[model samples]
Target: MQTKPTKSIYWGVVRLLGNNFLMAATDEGLCYLQFHDANPAAGVDEGAWSELAKWARAQLPEPNWVEDAEKLQPYILQLEEYLKGLRTTFTLPLDLRGTTFQQSVWRVLHEIPHGETFSYSQVAQELDKSSAVRAVGTAIGANPVLIVVPCHRVVGKDGSLTGYRGGLRNKEKLLLLERAGM
Candidate 1:
């Protein structure tokens, strides 16, 4: 049996908008981006590297992770421009890894224009599976790429804020940033 080659995942840390972020990319494209836990008063923490390794082990087969900021510079620049409210759309290639249902849900998320919000039910409807609201929420929560995927745009059906993997505070900030316009 022919074995598939293991893909190398390059990762790095970037501090932006008063928060530290962990970003990883493969030769194919960006695969992961998450907010790192850091005390605002103490600044960036060193534990984020270990967190990345743990995530890699769970997500890939014998993963090879390289710390390369230069490899992730383009993604960082775009994110910076976005957080600064200078860019509305992302052009970076994404290495989205998920089940078919999850990918479909994420595609709907991508279609949601910047500054606009969608409800979990609406996302399910977009998939032609209106009964899967809960499933849609699950997929959104599983989103690996944070701002780049724009999962923060999803809100409760009544327009209330919902859960965000990056925390509700960051979610609110993202929504406010979008509403404020570029």
Candidate 2:
């Protein structure tokens, strides 16, 4: 009982304050996710956001579409727990939307695992480069899923905190949470 048949694109503009969020959902799973700061482009758009709501409906346990305002609850819990130092890993199906090269870089980020950090040069080596350290940095910068993708785990070759879209302050918070055994 589907409609005219276009790919579903669900979205949500989360008021994360210092960590504004944009969550997107698709028919098969949650896709097209990202986060930004308090910029005007970061909030939810009623019409544009409907796609994500529809997509999220498709991913719900119920087969048919229904207004399930609570689908985002679990994700909120996960994030809250993360910030409180009560959680480290996220239990969500992610949709990493990027070009092939970006996806490759993201794959490297995923392998960083939880509570561990790596260097951009190290990631370049893992990708068989040993020299594309700068390129690796750019890819990481373009990452859509922040904490979930674990880009914060990637640092400078000399073990110093590097740049983060959420800012070095938030990055420090994430790293500190992990180092504290959260």
Candidate 3:
């Protein structure tokens, strides 16, 4: 699929709830936030920018990247507040890029309230594509915005945690965090 070229892309690293995340932004809005680990040899890892650049290269043409941690401060702050249970909804602009179907699934995912869970089939039914439960699962798996899109709110029909790109541990923690209102 063809994608528009963006003029600027910024990268930042922030810690929340004991985990480090790489935040990427553009003039349009926040694009990606990926999990990172600290480097034992040094301090916080700076490798996230390289990873972000690689992801951008595959998604866009000749992305102009800069390490502007400050540019993503607003998003980081909001996320911190969210982790602290001080916020239930995100107000940051999302530059989510995905197929039309994926976009629809992500949009519908937002309807799932915090501390609540919906089965994949339920999400499919909500989208009026009850037969596309697997497709809904795939879309949720492909969600680019992670916590911002709230894909973790999806569960198995039996209410069991299924899959999360960021891992089940993180997913479980997020659920518990929300459930405890912490």
Candidate 4:
């Protein structure tokens, strides 16, 4: 059976914290938060704006993409505040879509609290899925919302920093900002 394609409302792209991200909203809520330099030629391509949307769309199920920057203002402003150390928690509505297990992992990630770290095993234990430690790691790696979802808070059991899609530099900056109580 063929399922109908999901529709997407593009909230436009914005650069934040020396990185470029593409934010898109759906009727369900904010769906895509992608990291792509806006321009490789200019060397700002940590995650370019246009290329990100293409890549993000390709990764997820197809959606009828539309443009609407105004709807993205609140999220953009909140991100700016967080980067500036004036905000710690995100209140923006998120329409995160993933498999049931992935969603469960993401929800736990959200509860990790600011300025703290959790090991993959710790997260699995918290979810009472202790045997799924590796699965937990995979889910965390697949986190779509990045900082807002707090995947950067997950670390190796020994407290070593792990791989982050936004890059280790950005993760370090976030962890430092949180640790400084900024």
Q: Give every collision pair in model 3.
A: none
The candidates, ranked best first by TM-score, are 1, 3, 4, 2
Clashes of each: 0, 5, 0, 8
Report the alpha-carbon TM-score of model 1 versus the true structure. 0.90
Question: In model 2, which regions exceed 4 Å deviation?
Answer: 1-4, 15-19, 32-36, 39-69
User: How many backbone overlaps does candidate 4 show?
Assistant: 8
lDDT of each: 0.88, 0.69, 0.83, 0.78
A best-first ranking of the candidates according to their lDDT comes to: 1, 3, 4, 2
Model 1 lowest lDDT segment of ten: 39-48
After superposing candidate 3 on the true structure, give the runs of residues whose Cα lies further than 4 Å from its correct spot.
1-6, 39-51
Q: 25-50 in candidate 2: lDDT tens per residue? A: 54554554455444535456554345
Per-residue lDDT tens digits for candidate 4, residues 1-182, read: 99887766665667776766767776666666756545423532443445546555755567666767687888888888988788989998988867799999999988988999999999999889999999998888777788889999999999999889878887898899998983
**Each prediction's TM-score against the native?**
0.90, 0.71, 0.88, 0.83
Candidate 4 positional error at 61, Å: 4.6
lDDT of each residue in 35-79, candidate 1, tens digit only = 987753453366766666666676787877687889999999999
Q: Considering summed lDDT, which 10 consecutive residues are worst modelled in model 4?
A: 39-48
RMSD of 4: 3.5
